[model samples]
Target: MSMFRHLLGVVITLLFVLLTCAVILPILMLALLKVGLPFARWQALCNRWLDWLASLWMDANARHQQLLLPTQLEIEGLDNLSKQEWYMMVANHQSWVDILLLLRIFNGRIPYLKFFLKQSLIWVPLLGLAWWALEFPFMRRHTKEQIARDPSLQGKDIEQTRKACEKFRYNPVTIINFLEGTRFTTAKYVQQKSIYRHLLMPKAGGLAFTLAAMNGQLHRLLDVTIHYPEGIPTYWDYACGRVKTIQVHIRQVPIPAELIGDYTEDAEFRAGFQLWVNQLWQRKDDLIESMKSTGAN
Candidate 1:
């Protein structure tokens, strides 16, 4: 049975690659067309096309997963979502599976989910250009030492990332940031001496910087919490159709006026924002514990 599952995992992986390969060319083509056209209307048209292709890609994968796996999703708070509005989603990260789960669950329900990529990723040959064409915001991060050495470097990365964000102002988009920054692990949880029993420390600076950079254009916040009831599963376990259940909770909060400010320039705003984020994280940690205990989820 183990060998059979492993074989199925390989087959499932191959199918995923094939599906991606099928769409990549069209994606690349539209991306090039978008770049060549300087007109705003034309670029908007291209973006719409790209989003359609991505949504279709996601739907296709979902169909196959349902056919191949018995994974059951228990979800709450998705009814109010729409694709027409701009949103910022903050989620707790666990494994690579989180990305797939997010894309699958929210496909077509919101504007295509966008991720902030490392600035250096733009150099990758084809995928990078495609991501750029799709307008995935690339973030340039400078370490404290580097910033200390060059006082001028402070806030430069955010300025660049904000300019990249400016294009989304023309159309609605959902930007997702995993506050934990990295996937959660028991080791990491212990290392950080995490205040929450089930989560690593959630970083407020990224969300603050993103909000400030967007200049409050993001209209709502989608607070998403994902929990694996059977324990953290590997991608292979999910692909092999071994994982049984997933739970998701999304609480949509309005982007309050107070939450938008220069997180870099204003010390007071920074402190308030950090407190707000920490409180939010604490709630999520408590909720995850409830989910674990209640089993009704």
Candidate 2:
């Protein structure tokens, strides 16, 4: 039964992707060009279309696969969110399905979510063009070793990318960063011997840079915690209908006033910010444990 279910899920997901690439995507791309909207507007329009299509696909897939979303999923403190406000969303990475879950949950309540991606992905055929069209921030990350070998490369790339983000000033945006940097695996967990349960160590550099660039313009921080009841559910599970329930806890937090400055420049503020992030990860660790315990029953 599981094998058959998996096969069916893959077929459906592929069909959806093919249809999206062949039909919906080209029309949207042409529409953006015809309207003469800026890249940010074009991206926003594309994301809205993707979000709607995903929801429709999920509903149809769920009904066919006999899957169910959480009936008692609780979103606390959502009332604190303002439609006019800009936010920075940070979440622990788990699976590719996490993106779809976020889109479904935060749909109309918050500004459309965007992520900083690698510049290389910009040429990735269909999805690449789509991401570029959507105005996703594509960055070139240089390692310390590379920078040390070539002393002149210090802050050039980051500064160039930061300048590109200036265009976002005209549009309300919610920037999301998966602080863990990569999805969790037992091998990686063993390699890092991570302090937090079910989480990798939070990478502070990206968050630091993001906060520095956005500064006072971002009104709040959305700390979201997600858990899958039956291990880490894959995209196949979602499509095949094997994933019946998912629990997500959203805590809308105020961006600490002191963190509004350039975190890279101030030592004291940087230490304080790192400590706060550690505390958030610790709490998320505990939350994951509690969810696992509840799901066991």
Candidate 3:
């Protein structure tokens, strides 16, 4: 009976998501075109609507399942944030549910969170249009093998960075990147013998390129650490209300002047940047341990 109820819940939630995407997205796109609005303006409006719709959807689901987020989610250093400032947010990856937690935590406090996604994802059905309307940066990454075959591909990554970040100059934006590149698995942790307790290897190149492109325009870094009380929860667990409480610790780190220069062409700077990222990850690992111990107590 529990399994049957779970299946029914899954079916209903999926149908709700699909129906909302199908019905609302097309109308939003056509409305933008009919009004002869520029893409960015349309995107901003679309994102506002999407956010509202998403919150409504999630709230309904949570209520149905009798699930509640912690009433007093401790957020340190949020008072340091300025409404007029631009920010770069970096966090450790776990599951798709991270997005929900982020939105719930920082929804009105910061400017809308935008992710650096792949260019191919821009055409991904309903979700694609919504993302496009939100003005997410669609990046193109060049693999080492590809760049090795054609050296010219080296600079192409920077060019993609410039194009993707072009709209930020006019808007106060918060760009979020998961430095680990992927979620942590126990098998991966064992294979890599990762330095951090709850994270994978940090990829420095992406962070280097983003900082170089944004330069002084980005003011602050929101370093977030998220932990699940009962092991690492999957997206299914999140939707099914298995995740009862989530602890999010936010720290504000300044963008140092030393890191503002071009990192791709400078070998020394790249190495330095990697070291800086490693230090940050080490601190995050310690924080995760502290949170887990506290929760256990």
By TM-score, the best candidate is 1
What TM-score goes with each of the models? 0.94, 0.82, 0.82
How big is the positional error of residue 261 in model 3, measured in Å on the Cα after superposition?
Answer: 0.9
lDDT of 2 by residue, 43-87 (tens): 566555654554454445444333333223444445666556788
RMSD of each: 1.9, 3.9, 3.7
Give the Å shift of residue 238 in candidate 2.
2.4
Error of 3 at 59 (Å): 8.7
Which prediction has more favorable TM-score, 1 or 3? 1
Indicate whether candidate 1 or candidate 2 has the larger TM-score. 1
Model 3, 67-185: lDDT tens digits are 43222345565676665678999998888778767766676677667888888988886767766655677877888999999998978878887777776766677889999877778
Q: Residues 72-133, candidate 1: write the lDDT tens digits.
A: 99999989888899999999999989998999999989988899888888997655866776
- The candidate, 1 or 3, that scores higher on lDDT is 1
TM-score of 1: 0.94
- What TM value does model 2 have? 0.82
